[model samples]
Target: MTQIVQSLAEISKPYDALFCDLWGCLHNGVAPFPEAVAALQAFRASGGKVVLLTNAPRPAKFVIESLERMGCPKDAYDLVVSSGDAAQDAMFAGAVGRKVWHLGPSKDDGFFTEIPAEWQGQADIERVDFDDAEGIVCTGPFDEINEVPEDYRAKFLLAKMRDLPMLCANPDVVVDMGDKRIYCAGALAVLYEDMGGEAMYFGKPHPPIYDMARRKLAAIGGVEDGRILAIGDGINTDVPGAAGEGIDCLFVTGGLAHDQFGADQKNPDPELVRAWLGARQTDPRYTIGTLR
Candidate 1:
């Protein structure tokens, strides 16, 4: 019974707030999607409060700068809420006495800008001093473009050997970068968990990030969750995360799981799309090939 719409303009008026995902919905990492940007502008012009909610492991400031670099104008949305922003409050308190090793690209060093954790080590692809560390904090792969999950085998093995717990900042296993898909921190975290290491996720599909987004929405005078709409490309993260917060979700089919359904921003195969959604056990209230 999901309504597959051609554009968000078809249903923008009913919602007071739009909790939009950043990666797949806005841009494919390389540049901003003009249609997606236009859609957001149109929605905001109609009196809708737009919040760019993302699972990016980097802090809000970093996300903002990156978006600006990628041609995302400031007027496209009102605010940016990131997983790193939500995870900052929990880092220091949770690290109580443990020496933590940060496992991610140098781009995510902003995470330590405020967290009061005893720094054990910060390595990209090299294995950290697991013997001295009690836990691992992963933001993403050292090289997102050319790296795969298998590259982290040695690192995960070391963590597993020491029984170190991992805190994953982003829960997306893979993110679309233009026409290519790249592995993310969540993929490394999942690998460690599969290797018998305890992994804690701090991004979408988890409650804390959504809690932060909802708070932002409320501050903008959009208190009723029913009046808000969440839009994203990931069924695993966006749909489930919004539904858990009692908000309606509009799934974007072209960005992440497009290959599975042979879909694109301009064209979508309905039967294949339906089968994929059914297999995933997610029922988004609306579906679109793109945000437009």
Candidate 2:
């Protein structure tokens, strides 16, 4: 457990490569954190490789587009590996000939864009209604999960009993999308699992995302597990995921955990920070604070 003064320059020195989390550490979903972005730019200028690893359900290209709109230059990081990309890859590898019924917004249909042309129509969930589907590839139903009617439970059970595997594109159960707690695919996957369905996750806190990040890091001459640095704000996903890979982690205090600890309240005391840090006792190497 190494606790430094929480300066990005100082903390970034020991590692030659950085696998950074996009949402909370680099930017809140809506806006870019100039200071954090500047730190990444500085790291890149100094010859360090930076890769943005996000749990966003969209593919890496889509995430890059979103970041660009938020003023995040493509050069800020060498490459990106999103949960959506991982999920799509898993789906293609596992279900080459099987039918997939995705339950998400129409915009998310792009996830199956890489499927073979012959399977494209069958791969598309929007074209065929849910009742005619063979399997489920859930990205997220957004607010629809809250109002899932009781009658739907039987249908979900039947799908599970048929051994229809579900791929959860986004493993984040919930995210602070602006000022609201929006549900993600992980929540729906959990529900399906509770109903005895087989579910595969492809995002943060899962090895596939980390494995993808590690491969990207290696492509750009990054260090091995012992020397890589993982920076993020979500403890449940980021901290645990990094620790599982035997990498060091830096936790940002201005993200979800901070809000959960009431650090956003008026006159938040240091005790809250202390308690939060104490709760994360299992994380091997960590520091807590804003990116200064």
TM-score of each: 0.91, 0.85
Q: lDDT of each prediction vs. the true structure? A: 0.82, 0.73
Query: What shift in Å separates residue 206 of candidate 2 from its native position after superposition?
Result: 1.5
Query: Per-prediction count of colliding residue pairs?
Result: 1, 0
Pairs of colliding residues, candidate 1: 7-292
When summed lDDT is taken over every stretch of 10 residues in candidate 2, the lowest stretch is: 142-151
RMSD, candidate 2, Å = 3.7
Q: Estimate, for each residue in 6-115, the C-alpha lDDT of model 2 and write its tens digit.
A: 56797677888888888767876778877788888899899888888888888888888889888887778898889987777777665522467777776686786645
Candidate 1, residues 1-292: lDDT per residue as tens digits? 5778899999877788888999889998999989999999998898888999999998788999999898899989998998887766556556312467888888898887644233334322223455677778788888888988888898788878877878788999999888888898889988888888888876898998888887777787755787889999988899998888888999998878777767354567788878888887888999998888
Root-mean-square deviation of every model: 4.0, 3.7
Our tally of clashes for model 2 stands at 0
How high a TM-score does candidate 2 get?
Answer: 0.85
